[model samples]
Target: MCRLMVYLGDPIVVADLVTRPSHSVMKQSFAARERLTGGPGYIPLSINADGCGIGWYAREVERKDGDVTPGIYTSISPAWNDVNLERITPKIVSPLIFAHVRAAMVGTPVVQMKCHPFSIGRYMWMHNGEIGGFSALRLPLLNALRPEVAQKCPCFESDTAVAFAVFLNQLDDPMVQLAPTALAPLMAATIATIRHVAVQNGRGDETSMLNFVVSDGRTVVAARYTNATDEPASLHYATGSAFRRKKEASADFRLEYHDKRSRLGLVASEPLTDEVADWAQVPPNHMVVLMHSEGSFVDTLVLPIDCESPEVQDHVTRCFRALDQSIADNAPQALQQAPGGIPRALKRPSFATGEDVPVATAPETIFEETGQSVLSVAADGTRVFSGSPAGTIHVFDLQTGKLLHTLDDHSHAVFSLAVADGRLFSSSMRVVNEWDLTSPDGAARARPRLLSTRHHSDGDVLALAAAKGVVIGGPRDVSIHVEKACADGVTQNSEATVGEQKGELVRARALLTDALTGGHVSTVYAVVVRGRWLFSAAGDAAVKIWDLDAGKHKASLYGHAGAVMALADVQKQPSSGPDADAQKERSNGSDAATSPSDGQEERSDAPDGGFWLLSGGRDNSVRVWDTDTRECVRVLKGHADDVLALCGGFGGRFYSASADGTIRAWSTATWSCTQIFHHEDTVPLAIWPTERGVGSGAADGKVRSWLVDRK
Candidate 1:
């Protein structure tokens, strides 16, 4: 018996979904709630008695500042006992995740590499059930793998893992790669290859549990089928928005089927969750596929035959002809559909050259220049939140550059700043302090209250902000810590506090601890909080999405030219059409499509309500990407120096701060520069929107308040 979980949605932390969930994969190894083989009598369950394994892949993120190769992790130990699980779960995030737990059906090997979810280069394959004639047909199947693939087979004797290698090898064959007009045909060839050797080796009419899964680190394909009469195993698939929603309303979240945004199609022998509506049974002898397109399901028939029978020769020949026909019939349709299974092509962005406009206008005069170096700026419309490298926090008038009040509350450089709930939170080199910054003069000589203290271990604190919660990102500790407003108000000294509540706060406390620390090789650069998720960019050249409530990673977004320095969520249009039928056919997770077994009405894809994410990098350009579609909507390039910070306004206005000592504004639609405000002595480090308007903080210890026409 084997258990598997496939998650497609926002990148989530492996621990929150795979390890810590009520019915987590970790628990499934010993105490699986639902068994595919009827009841749990067939296989004994116990965390200590049963062996477990997990396999996962991370996405390759491209940033303007850097790029990262995708990462994969596999384990053989019981997930709960493995210290590494706790170590790496929060640190790594991916949008598309696959996890599996094993309860060996037949061939139980002591070695770890023999586990399912096998990998060949970027491709990973796993099988839930076993082939009925594996023992008798092993030799024939092993021989079917090309010599190259056979060579990669396990030294240890596990049938499932070995079978996976064979499948991967066959997939790499030139024939399958070049001629896959339809995946069904290629899959048919694989099945034929397996049957050929089984009979030649004198195998029997074995009933095989062929619930198969494979992914090339991008597209994932899973199938459930058996040669038995009744049904292979209990397999289920669920799709819709509710399956992907968070488990909690707070930032601390869990996986719950709330909305239908999450379209999950699971092909398990038995349903993982008890929600009957959340699971659907995969019909006998049929294959379900999850690709970019929603309608990727296809049914194929493979008649079972006895090995060593006179019909063997006929079976082989028939198999070849059937495979050829299936492949030919499926090729044209698959090719016509573009990447991500969407039939329609994405629109190319329009760009303009400076030569087209000989005389570009300068920024309109708004706020009188404040002669202070701004380290970070966030404004609404009536009030401004500004911080300086000199450790000064200020609140000023957006309409006029009148200095509200200067407070010397911090002791180190304020590299980043954010304002929310009428309070201003600023992060220095080693500490996080909050100012009762509702009014302009709130910072005047007023000592800021300390909410939390984090020891600096990496290097420096680069970014910080406060919203529904407090978020801090920097080079050394690159972790996010949230202190609810109720957690405020402790004036006790550090020694007394640590001794008193260390035991209670140690458990179930969502605060950032030593475990959230970054790996020595990587640095966290910036973090942006939106609803229940936290998006972080790192020195590793990746942008990771974390689910705050669950305190785990959701997904990792890649596709940038450099290390992501800034992340901002803006608005955008729907890339697909309005017809309900057409939209349902399109794929959502990564670039794979899913087709339903029962022919049903199609869904439409029109512009729905969603925001676009803008990330700036050392690559010296800004990319606007649709969060829902995960497609790059636009790319704007004009910065002279590295773009260090970015902020988008509520009125379609966007602003960026750079090493070139200037804050530039852009029209989100045309992506054209609207204004360029040059700083003489101050170098803009970070920028954000405040209650009053847009504000820019600089390296020269000055915070500038800017007023823009919102029309």
Candidate 2:
């Protein structure tokens, strides 16, 4: 067994993958965490000291027409002890890289030629597992390869080399660039062919771990498979917007997803970093394909593979024979049928031509409170809840735009509203009211009966967030109040207050307060609860992160030039495939709010499903911050005035309402403004994202819904 890694994304120095990480491929050479033991042909040695190799495509600036083949370097020395590798890797940078550290199979020689990654024409390949009883099947495997592929094969005495030959034999022209869709199936077919040969030679019962990775400069496909039941060699992958070494001298690395689209993709036999959440195990019998999309973002796809299937077995046999005959007959069209049942490559709509930009039509008045300015808006799956300055909460059907109920709860203006746990929470001066959406009484259900009202001793309640029986209220003052629902139908108040008291930061299990000497220094404008962490946007131009469990200040993110007025959490979405739906459902069902700007839903706090915080600032820009890294990855500046409200996680898009009288829809994939809904002479105060459009509360005393065509 060996350690191998593949990187397909932004250009990075070779050391980033091979040498620098805490558990990099080089480190895995000696201290692998998940390599199989006691398997057929498996050596008991813990160290992969046989050899080391790396292959990388030339940087764009150095690439010429026919000279784009990758550069390869191999040495018959332990990767850690390779002085030449250490000296040269830091100086080499490439966008696509394949690296491996070998612990050669029982009979394999420790020669430079034996070290992966093997290259033929424009492709590079690396293997992490051994083929059981390969010595008996070598001649048969070579004989099965097409004559042209056999002529070009390097004849290296390695199972990986034989597998590479089989892979090339399936390609009509090994030198021609193939799409990831084409490459993925051919890779699957290669595994099937190897299995067929193993079964033919009576080695079917023996374990054959075929963890392989192949790349054609622009596209990459990696497989984790084993003929035996035990698990395939520990293959894992991670995707994010940026992959960075935490500190200059530290081996720790971080993969941050600033938004939905992934800018980096990594596949490895062992995790490169100690951050457990950063890596996801690739299923035993599956392949992961990384390819560049037309939108210029990397797309990752995980596909299941069944080597035992008769259809797959026959497909591999016929694919190669058909390819060889096609080459002889000079019939390129026959190559179309060569790749069978492989999922077609995803062709995402290109954002370059503005085709994906949403079209915002005229706003349809959902409800008009005659003379009261709409102050807050929140939404669930079917209803739009709008709060007014008159303390009246109006519920409207999302589909019909008809008023469902009007409840008078507070004596003061309603500034914020939130929906969570089948309840609606509305906040006003010195009090927060909770209404039961699932109330048993039919009459009370339509007009959700006010369950409880907690009086705040501080200033006006400016923002509200509720989840898991706890309600957090951000006040006009620099303090945050926590209210817990008691089993006895009462409310328990625990104020986490932060203020200028004695210029010292206060800490408590429930009370939270930032000192004027250090923290917020102004009113808390918005509060969002995600898991055990509470995020508060304040008038001090900063967003502070609080650990709810500890009730202590964790970190403060600062980038806004002026006061941060509105805050929303845009839950990160899976880039592609079946997992996207599962991940989306998980995000929607958990702490992450479906409509973040509504200040109502509990946004997903699944630590692994990272989130981006969108803060609308008085600086007239909306900044996107990666909560994990606490870094502002993007600052969207299109609003001519201060951005007042923000909402995201609606069909790969986010919307921002500005005091400039416009609500702008942004594509989360591109981070570009796609559509703008103008409110004429009024400032849109709050926005909530819906399935088909966005609902807004504006200064013009109207609750409106705008149809956003995102298709």
Candidate 3:
């Protein structure tokens, strides 16, 4: 076992968190005061000074200034005398950080590659405690890794690294990449998979300390756990709104806990100071979640892992489903229909359009490895795309229900995506790449030949809307926060040029003022354009409608009590021709741009004959607003947690994805939730309306589609 520490909340200096405390992570390395004993006086190593490691999300500025990935330093030398660490620790600061000191189990080696904090892409993982009979467990666990991950994972003698490999296998599973909460079970199953293999290989008798931690550089998940009979190593956490040590430099600097009820959490192997009362010990079989609250403060959740629970079955089923060929054969078929068109085959008995049979929900087909932040469907219904937390984009073919391409183009997470004129627009902090979807397989690769790149120096392109010929970008950036904090000397150094660059980040936020109509007071999270009308949702808790052509604010529609996180626009339409020629045209062009008002009747919901805007919010409620009157017609409430995304005009229904990990489908007539798909396994962050059904992306850097099939 070893000493492990995880910090998730406001930014803090590595020197203070890992070095300055009275019993700091540095102290733990050479003088671990509480080493555990097996039995009969056989105490494990007292000094965890075999090696040390620190992993942190480098300043976005560091990356903005050309530093590519997060900083991860692992050394075979003890941290107490590591010259490089001493020089770097004081200068480095980050919101998310992990520092670990190692005391290798009996069979493991003391080497740099065997240090804590194993990382791949944006994911960083670490472990304390040993795997029972690790040598026996190692090969199988390593073999279980995803081929891509296996190839990339460095060869190391540490059992912790192998456990991380197993965890990586579960993590990179397309199904496991749904959401953050889904990670807990996937992690548990990874441990279970290891133990099952260990037992099968006849190595189950040894001790196993499986306390583990992992993060995607934003959301942090840590577990204090052990095998069936073993007691866990010490693990405690402290959380509050304010996490600070005194501003004054002192050798006895200890993290002070204030505002105990507020949102912020930190996990460590032991208490950082003598504030024993403020620290709470983690339960043996539970996982700790730490994520940013509304802003910088953290929201924490502790969940139990019951190995025999249905989670295991679901995880297993998903794994089998992926490996087996049966899924492609038994895949749910989409009864393709124009939006608002209810097919006659499954007509409700009470309000029958043609059939006398009772209506039932269609069979659910879950697509795996969906990106978390954004999901967008091509207007023609031929392609569906999702953006991942790992800076990847997954593209799927709607007809065959098969993955077409995985575009790993962005150096940061792809936050905004839009489809226009046979091209996909993907934007991150600064770079925007437009990919020509009509190109071949090689065209989906990073720096694809047909791809065009553009830079938005204004700010992060938080939302994107591409329609007809107008491309509107709604910007948001966290750089301003960094700049503001820098002014207060939060990250100040003696260097003057560094301070000026931080100021540039704030000025960058003001650069895109030309596009702002009446100036959104907060980060713009959504953007949609219909004809000359543009709809956007910002942190101001209001949906602003602007006239794109006039470049002026029309009205600010207020309804959502919390920040409006998602928005979808559906134009009222009358029944269209069922002829083959009409269907062909519908598949070739964006159905969203077609104006039925030219000849067809407007849907009853839009009495004034205009488009309807459906918006979802952090309040866990969705409000349907009529653009003509700028009034909310209905408030849909079915999700138990914050609604992160909304999708509408999919086969006469609307869909919303929530933080509680579910998708609720709404009826067009009543604006009521007709079906709730409990994908509670993953936090669904993005949802998109598709001609066949719906597509969703979760926090775990995966994307999937749900195809509805008639009974």
Query: Evaluated with lDDT, which candidate comes out highest?
Result: 2
| Model 3 Cα lDDT, one tens digit per residue, 569-610 | 766544321233332211113211211211123233222435
Arrange candidates, best TM-score first: 2, 3, 1
What candidate 2 gets wrong by more than 4 Å, as runs, is 38-45, 307-419, 422-711
> By descending lDDT, how would the candidates be arranged?
2, 3, 1
- The models' CA-based lDDT, in order, is 0.50, 0.69, 0.58
Residue-level lDDT tens digits of model 2 in 210-236: 998998887889999988877778898
Provide the global lDDT of candidate 3 against the true structure. 0.58
Residue-level lDDT for 98 in candidate 1: 67
TM-score of each: 0.41, 0.52, 0.44
Superpose all Cα atoms of candidate 3 onto the true structure and report the RMSD in Å to 1 decimal.
22.9
Residue 539, model 1, lDDT = 35
lDDT (tens digit, per residue) of candidate 1 on 361-475: 2322233345555556666445556665456667666656566666676664455666677556666654555555433465443433444344433224555645654444543
Name the 10 consecutive residues with the lowest summed lDDT in model 1: 342-351
User: Cα lDDT for residue 347, model 1?
Assistant: 15
